[model samples]
Target chain A: MAREGNVVNLVENFKTSIVMPTAQSFPAKTVPVMESDAVATSKRPIIRIDGVTKTYRNGTNALEKIDLDINAGEFVSLVGPSGCGKSTLLRLIAGLGTASAGEIDWPTSTYDAKGHPMPDLGFVFQEPTLMPWRTVFDNVYLPLKLGGVKRKDAHDRVTEALEMTGLARFAAAYPRQLSGGMKMRVSIARALVKRPKILLMDEPFAALDEITRTKLNNDLLHLWEQQGWTVVFVTHSIYESVYLSSRIVVMTGRPGRLSDDIEIDAAYPRNEAFRTSSDYGEYCTRVSAALHSASAAGDGEH
Target chain B: MSVIATEPRRLRLLPLHFMRSETAGRWLHAVVPITFVLFLVVVWEIAVRELGVSKVILPAPSVIGEALAQNWPVLLRSLAITFSVMIEAFLLAVLSGIGMSVIFARFRILEMAVFPLAVILQVTPMIAIAPLLLIWVGLDHVDRALLILATVVAFFPILSNTTLGLRSVDHNLRDLFLLNRATSWQRLVELELPSSLPYILGGMKISGGLALIGSVVAEFVAGSGSATGLAWRIVEAANDLDTPRMFAALFLLSGLGVFNFAALTALQHLLLRTWHESAIRTER
Candidate 1:
C-alpha cells in the first residue's frame, strides 16, 4: 500500500533512456543495403569487448587480452583460482577500473574520448556495500534517485526490487541491523532496482557462510531466470561456478588469460536435488581439471 | 506521561537507540532509597533535638529550611550570576572547540601545531594563571574570560569524540557513498554528522559538569566583589563562619551542577530522541 498515485510511476520518468534520432543502419539484413549504401552503424554491443587487457604494472598481469563477448541477456561467470583474472574481468565490465592495453566494447557502454555515449553500468561489490546510514528501501531507491526519478514515484520501484530479493519485509531496516545474508540481499535489491541491462557481480557471496551462500546461489539463479539481464559474475570457487553458471569462463593466474570456456549443461531452475546430484559432481570435477590446466600452463612443455 | 517503560525483556524489541528503559523507571526504582533518605532525615531531626546538638556545626534540616527562606534572594542572585557565566562559557567553548576540531581533523599539520597548545591550556591550572589573567583582563572580564578557559578545557572531549565519530564511518558504507560520487558536503551531511551525534552528546555530558567547576574556580581564584557569583558567596559565608549559609551555597552549587547535567541529558534525549542508542534504550 502506498500513498496517492501509482507507485510504479517512476518507470515513466525513465522513458528518456534511449539514444537520439539516427538513420536506420543495419549491417546487411538482406545484403542489398550494405552493398549499395554505407550507413554508419550503431557499433553498440548490447555489450562490446575489444582487445581488453589488464596489467597491474607488477609485471604481474591480472588479465591479458580479456576480449570476451557478452550479448544482451547472457549469464556469464568468470570462474578461476584466487589470483586469476575473474574478478578483474568483472571490474572492467563494471567500469570500476580500466584495462591497460585493450578496450571493452559493451556496444552499450563504449564511449569515445568526448564521452558522447557509453552504456550505464550497475556494480554489485563482493560485499553488500549497503550504506549503513540508509534503510534497505532507501538503498534500493538510490539508482532511481540518481536517475532523477521523483521521490514519490521511486518508492514503488524500490519496493518491487526489495520484494524481488525477498527483502521487502526488512525494507526499513538498516544494513547493520541485518544478518549477513540479508545485507547481501539488500545489495542485490539495490542493483536490480535500477534495471541495468548489464549486472556485474564480483564474488558477491564469496565471504558468506555455506548454507546462506547456497540459498543465495539458488535465489540468484531464479532472479536471473526471471530478469533475463546479462550477468557477469566473478568467483574463485569452482564449485560455485558449476552450481550456478550457464557458461563459465575459466582463466589462468599471474599473466591472467582465458584458460577455458566450459558450458554448464545442468537444466534450468536448479534446486537442492541438483546441488546434491552426481552430475553436479562430475561437472565440478571437469571444471577443476580446466582450472588445473590453466594454473599449470607451462609445466608440461619440457 | 506514562511514557516510561518499567519493563526489561521488551528492551530488545525497540530499535537499538530506544533501549534504555531502566532510566524511565527511575522514580519507581528509587522509591525505597528515597524513603530511606526521608527516614534518616526524620530520625536525625528527632535525635538532634533530643541530644541538643548545637546549630553551630550541624543545623537541623528544619532550621536550614528557615535559613533557605531568609537568604533566598541573595542565593538566587548569586545563582543567576554563576549560571549565566556557566552558559556563556559553555557556549563559547563548544563553538571554538568544534570549529578548531574541524580544522584540526582536516589538516594534520594544524592538529600537530594546535593540539599541543590545547593540552597546554588544559593542563595549566586556572588559579596559577588567574592573577596574571586578572591583571591582563580586568578582574571582572578576566574572571568571566577565565570561565571561558574552563569552558575550553571542558570543550575538548566533545570535539575529540565528535572528530572520531566523523572518522569512524564503516568502509563498506564509505564505498557506497563514494560509488554514488557524492560531493564532500553531501558525504559529511549524510554520513558524518548522524554517526557522530552519540559521541558528541556523550562528550557534552562530561563538559557540563566541567563548565560548572570552571566557573566556580574562576570565582575562587579571582574572588567575588560587591556583586559576583555563588563562589564569591561561598567565600563570604565560609569566612564569616556562617556554616549553614556556606552549606546552603554549596548545596546551591551542587544543585546547579545537577541542573546543568539534567538539562544536557534532557536536550540529548530530545534531539537524539529516535536516533541514539542511549536514548533508544531510555525510550524503550
Candidate 2:
C-alpha cells in the first residue's frame, strides 16, 4: 500500500523535473528501472539523478553529466578505479556536498522548512567513524538522541541494532576496547538504529580482512533483505559488487562518467557457496571487462 | 615471598623485575623517593657537623626542624593567607581562561584582536610587572595585587590549550553532528567540551603549579609591606639573619607545590581514565 503512494509521488516528481528549465539537457532514454521489477510493478525510481555535474573549487571537474535512477529495494553498486568521483557522487546523494550543476531529486522523501530533503537516510563511510569516547550502546543511540528521543526511550532500539550487528555482548565496551571488526559492527549499528529508508555505504568493509569482510557482506545482505531498504553501495572490488549488487554501474575517472551498466541476474541469500560458484566467476569476469573498457574509454577521450 | 626469601641468590638475580606487580610498583614509587630524601638529609646533618660549617650559612636539618616547631603557629597562619590567595588566583584563572577560550572559539575575530596582547603579557616577565601592579592597585590593596599577578601568570596556558582543544574536534564527528542537525549549542556542549577535556586538564595541571609560583613571586615583591604570606616570612627571616626559619618557609612552599600538582594529576586520571589514550592503561 505504501509502495502505491510512492508511485504517485514518483509521477509528481517526474512532472516537476520535466517542467524544470534545465530538463532539456537530460537524455530521454536515461530513466533507470530494474529489469526484473520493471514488468512486475512499473514503479518509478525512488531517486533520480538528472544531468548532474560537479566541479571542485580549483577548476577540477570531478564528475560530469551523471544520469542514473535508483529504484526502491534495489542493491546498486557504484564500482570504479581510484579517484573516479564515485565517492563524490555518493556524497552528493547523501547531501554532504552541493552539485555544481543539475540536480538530484529524492522523490518519495519529505523536505524540511528549508526545502532540503530531510535525511530519512544513513551513510556509512569507509572508516568506521565511531566515537572513541562513547560505549557501543551509546554510540548506536546517538542518532535517536539527536532526533529528540530521550536515552531511556532509545534504549530498546539501541539494543536491537546492536543485536542485529551481533554486538549485543559488547554494548558496554568502548570503541578502543573493541577489535577492528567489532568497531565496524558498532558503526553499522549506529547507522541502522534509525531505521532509515536509504542506506548509502562507501566501501564500509574495505579495511577489514577478507574473512571478516565476507562475513560482514553476508550479514549486510541479511539485514538488507529483512529491512527492505534501498542500498547504494560504493566499492573498488568487482567481486564484492557482483556478489552483492542487483545491478552494477561502472564509472571512469578524469571527470568521471558512467560507462557501463550490467545486471548481476543472480538469486539473493548469497553465501560462501555462491561466492565459489562458476556463475559468480562469470559475473566477476564480465564486470572486470566492463571496468577495463571504461578506463580505456577514459584514455581514448583524452 | 617465602620462595624468593629461601633462594637469596635468585632474589639478587631477579631484583630488577621484582617490582612487576602493580601494587609493588606503586609502593616503590612512594617509598623510594622518601628514602632517598631522608638519606640526603642524614648526609647533610653529618657533613655540617663534621665540617664545622657556620650555622649562619647552612642550618642543619635538625635545626631547621626545631625552627619549624617553634614558629609553627605563625607559619600556619602565613600558610593560610598564602593558600587563600593561591586558591583565589587559580579559580579565577580557570573560570576566566575557559570562558575566554570558548568566546574566542566562537568569534575568531575577537581572538585575533586579543591573542597578540595575551602573548605580549605572557612573554613579559611577571616580576617586572608586579611592582607596577602594586602601585596601580595601590599598596593598601596588596592582596588584590597579589591575586592579579598570580592570575595573570596562570591564565595563559589554560586559555591557549582550551582554545586549541575547542577547535580540535574530529572532522568526521563534526560531519556526523551536522548530519544529525545538531544545534550550535548542542554541538558545543556535547561534542566540543567533552573532546577538549583532556587538553583542558593538561593545561590545568601546568596552571596549578604556576599559580603557586605566581603567589610566591607576588608576596616576595610585596616584601615587608605585606607580611602575611610564606614568601614574606622568608624575606623577613633573611633580613633578620634567621637562616633556619627561611629554610622552614621554603620547605612549606615546596610541599604546597607538590600537593597542588598531585591533586590535579589525580583529578585528570579520574576524569579521563576510561576514554582518553593518555589516561587509559594500554594493557587492557
Residue B169, model 2: Cα distance from true site in angstroms:
1.5
The TM-scores of all predictions, comma-separated, are 0.74, 0.89
For model 2, residues B1-284, the per-residue Cα lDDT tens digits are 32354544533523545655677778888988999999999999999999999878999999999999999999999998888888899999999999999999989999999999999999999999999998899888899999999999999999999999998988778878888888888888878888999889989999999999999998888876664899999988999999999999999999889889999999998888888899776654
lDDT of 1 by residue, B27-59 (tens): 445676788989998998898898999877877
| Whole-model lDDT per candidate | 0.72, 0.85
- Across A1-302, the per-residue lDDT of candidate 2 in tens digits comes to 77556555544443343322234633354443344335445444677788789999999888988888787889999988778799999999988889999788876677999899885788888888877777888889988888889999999999999999999999999898988888888888888999898999989999999999988999999999999889999999999999999989888876888877677778988888999996787678767767886787676776
Could you tell me how far off, in angstroms, the CA of residue A231 lies in candidate 1 after the best superposition? 2.7
Evaluated with TM-score, which candidate comes out highest? 2
Taking the tens digit of each residue's C-alpha lDDT, what string does model 1 give over A113-174? 88734465567888887665567888788767655688799988888888988987997886
Question: Ten-residue segment with the worst summed lDDT in candidate 1 chain A?
Answer: A14-23
